[model samples]
Target chain A: MKSNNSFRYFLIFAGAGIYQWAFWHETPGLNISIFTAFIVPTLLFLYPESVKKVPFWLVLTGLLSASLAIVVHASLFATIMYVISIILFVGFAHWSQTKSPVFAIPSSIANLVLTPYTFFAFKNYVATNNKKSSVFLKWVKLFVLPVVILIVFFTIFYNASDKFAEYSDKVLFPIQDFIYNLFGNITFASIFFFVHGILLITWILIRNKNTNLSDAEKNQTVNITRNKVRRKRHFQFLGLKREYLSAFILLVLINLLVLAANIVDIVFIWFGFEFKEGMNLKQFVHEGTYLLILSILLSMGILLYIFRKNQNFYSKGKILKVLSFAWIFQNLILAISVGVRNYHYMEYYGLAYKRVGVCIFLILVFFGLITFFIKIMQKKSSYFLLKFNSWAMYLLLIISSLFSWDTIITKYNIKHCKELDYEFLVHMSTKALPFVDINKLSTDLSYKNPWIINSNYNYDYFYVFSMRNYYVKQVFNFLYDWETDKFLSWSYYDKLAYQNFMSNPELVKSYKIYKDYRIKKNQIENGNKNSVQNRTPALHSDESR
Target chain B: METKIQFKTELLHYILMNPVRSEQSGRVVFSEQFAIILKIITS
Candidate 1:
């Protein structure tokens, strides 16, 4: 608080607090406030010695001010283009900073804020710039990687296509679909990803802080007169503990689980497969439940063996005993909760090829094996090549046997149900679209329908009779007035009311001619002088026109 | 008077999305009534 830089720090913190407060109110404005957070804090945190940095704040203020001014502006796209200039100019300036890449923080900020705009910008940049266009070709291999994997998977599962159909047709498959819809949803994935990133960043920051603190201590020993705040700050930062180590290890496992999920997604694509509704959650729970149970049982056995070895009763200490039992208890609870949620009813259970779930399970197993390695290393106090070899052998045997049997079973099932069921395909298409309420559909349609024209040919009409509409209404009954507003459109009525007619050049020209004629006729009826002003119209409208 | 009228119009636009109990009544203003509270703070 006494330092000259302290005021700048206070201002940065205050501004950030205000930004977050303001950010909570505006749905999309959160991104802008977040951008400001990165910009202002990063400036003060990096360089506290500058007046020119004030102009950056001014630019940010102007952009927001202009946003308010242009809220009612007809052309939102043009307004967006103008806002892009503010973001880009500031971003470019930040990136040009030569020292520590504090500016990289704002780059991330820009990425989040202008994700939609910047994606198109990057695409355009590549399209227009000759030098950058070729850069895309270099990393095209990443996209090809999934294709190659899919090809390999298809080749391996060549005989199981029929089985896939049979498995999908089962009544219990919808339950599986529901599980997937609930648990393996993109929302959960996004939340998990965000949490994982934060944890990773926290770990890195902690490590850096430790290094800086140790360096500061070393410097203190070298310099004699720097008692600055000696005795008071001695215990402010504690050395790393076994607890933090465990947390870090848990973080790594979480990351591995996420990676496994992504790999499972790839396997699904490779097999030309989809998770059954309600089954994703079940599958997710099932995979995790089994691994955790196995890990707990295995850990319990190890703990019991340790207790026997140190049989002095006193050596079997309270803390160690509690930790071992707690770990087992936690794993058991995890298994039960997941199992109940996913596979509680025997009638609901069925066998299906969930390669994604399998893949994610494989990842967890991999982490367990790594944990095993760490344990052996800790106990032996040495690196053991034999331990690694034995572990690999065990994993290979388990994986190959499991996969081979599953494949065989799947093949047999598919072969029995060889003929393609048109009904099943129709059911799937219906499920994908869901039930559609005209009112809800129109609201969704509003953002996309720029013409602002709701006529006799309501957007709801298309959705009401549609298979898509039925599917939508079955799923989302949250919208009010979802049951009503059922209507249909004839082709001619649809063309005039909807924006479809405007899309065709010939129709547009014809409409213009008809509109002018109607206007003049109306004006003449009203005996208005403006009727003459409308007379420079087409003398003869062509058939196409 | 001029500044107040302009401010009132701007504020009206800002708060238009929010519904009030009545055009003329005692205002039991909720903290989250208008997004402008956040807008001004964030700015």
Candidate 2:
């Protein structure tokens, strides 16, 4: 038992050490950080002894998926994937120890929220009773006192004699410099992060061990009791056949109204009807998409409420069910109509992140409506629907995260579109900057609108100066501004993009020439204007002559 | 009852629902108290 405890402590220490190294180095990016974080806890606490088979495989797959996401530029998609992986990691970790997937969500949340308290409690308990810890404390005290005394005596001796002081300074200068360099780089934030990592690992191990032991003890004791009879209250609303009939009628009415709207969309949008005087693509697309989403959600809520529990056993339930299904089907058509509108808008104004988000949201709503239909047809419980939809969302988010959307958007606009939004492209993040053909843009704009070149020059100067200042000065001016902290905060992708921009010597030279030309022109114009403003009558007459 | 009233009451009931734990002793300590205890121990 003592050895096992010692091993656990060693693993915790090792994990903290790795965390400190990664926090400073910032080489491998987010993947290494997340992998180490998840793996450390799993290995120390919920490993082979406690982890179940299914959850183990699920967590492993999630880790790999997150790793793949990191490789793909850490865009929004990758962020979503990372978030899902964390959820799955937490869920599976809980399931492994308890052999029950029911409390997975709450248990995971508790584990995260209660980590500090768990660490404190465990440390307090161990310090009170553990002989090894007591001995370690004693040794530390012994060692620290002697070191203090020696340092004091040496200081006194050095102060007493100039010769002794010089000799000691010569001997210790290099060592002093080394120690200063080492301690100078360590900051409060790094120490806090190191302590957090150790606490998290310790919390997971102790919490899981205690939970497993308690569960085992619970299994050993079996209590047998006779079931008690309960009184049945009169449910006055249950026998309301008229209410069901009226609800069915209302559902049909709502469905017909939705169907009429869908028909209009099919005719006007799908068949390419010309817009009215003030009707623009933006208005048409933005207005209907959100309404469609809200309507679908509202329809699902109504269906769930009407068919909940034993209400499904109503005599007129079949009629209501048919009407509900028809309404859901109409909602699906509405989702498709919204998608068509979004596509048209994208065609006119070009694709953007929000438009793409609308498409993904529509797809999810379509799946949700389909699941609602299934829930109704199979008479499944609400829990069944909840679990099914949760898993579906998880899968959708994972798949979505795999795509590098910025690269996709940049490539598509550049290759397929006739005219590119150059300003938009320039404003895009470092990931998308490489795909933009700035040379072609520069030539085209220089011929058409030469003034744009001046503006572009200004934009580039401001962008570079601000980015450099942000990464170098403002970021490093914090309280815990260690080398590792600075490195971790710096965006390597941006650095690479800046390097790529500077690689084009011709572009840089052209920008410099254009700046000089603008400066000279401005100076000449200012000189002439000033002369005109301050001119005397004789000077004005001479100028005229 | 009208449908609106019934819906409102149901929503209220759900909002008011609380978990019932059988073993009060097993409840996790609040973080503030835990921190205070830690401070005492270290001091």
Fnat per model, in the order given? 0.00, 0.00
A1-545, model 2: which lDDT tens digit per residue?
22334445666687666566555434334535454465645553535543446654655565566566664454545655665565456545544554223334556556666667656565543323355555655677889989999999999999999999999999999899978654555668667878887875565454432232224323422122222455477764544476677677789889889989989999988886665666676767787787878888888888888776555666558878888888988888888888888887777567777788888888788778887888778777665666556666666766776676776777887877776766555445455666765334322211222222244422322232211222111111111121213343333443455456457654344333323332333333344232212211110000000
Cα RMSDs, all models: 29.0, 20.7
Chain A (alone) TM-scores for all candidate structures: 0.23, 0.68
The collision pairs in model 2 are A77-A401
Best by TM-score: 2
The DockQ figures for the candidates are 0.01, 0.01
lDDT of 1 by residue, A1-545 (tens): 11232332234344444443333212222244344445544444433432255334433444544343233221222234334434433442333331111232245343444443432243332213344445545677668999999978865665578775565458557888887643443455455544443332222111111111222222322111212343466455432244334434553454455346435543543344444666665555556557655654565455434433122133224444444444443443443343333333211333233322443344454444444334332332111222243334333432332222222323333344344221222122111211211222221222221111233322322322322222222222111111111121011111222343245454344334333333433343334533322232111101110
Which 10-residue window in model 2 chain A sums to the lowest lDDT?
A536-545
Q: How far is A275's C-alpha from truth in model 1 (Å)?
A: 16
- Could you give the interface RMSD of candidate 2 in angstroms? 33.8
Q: Give me the candidate number with maximum DockQ.
A: 1
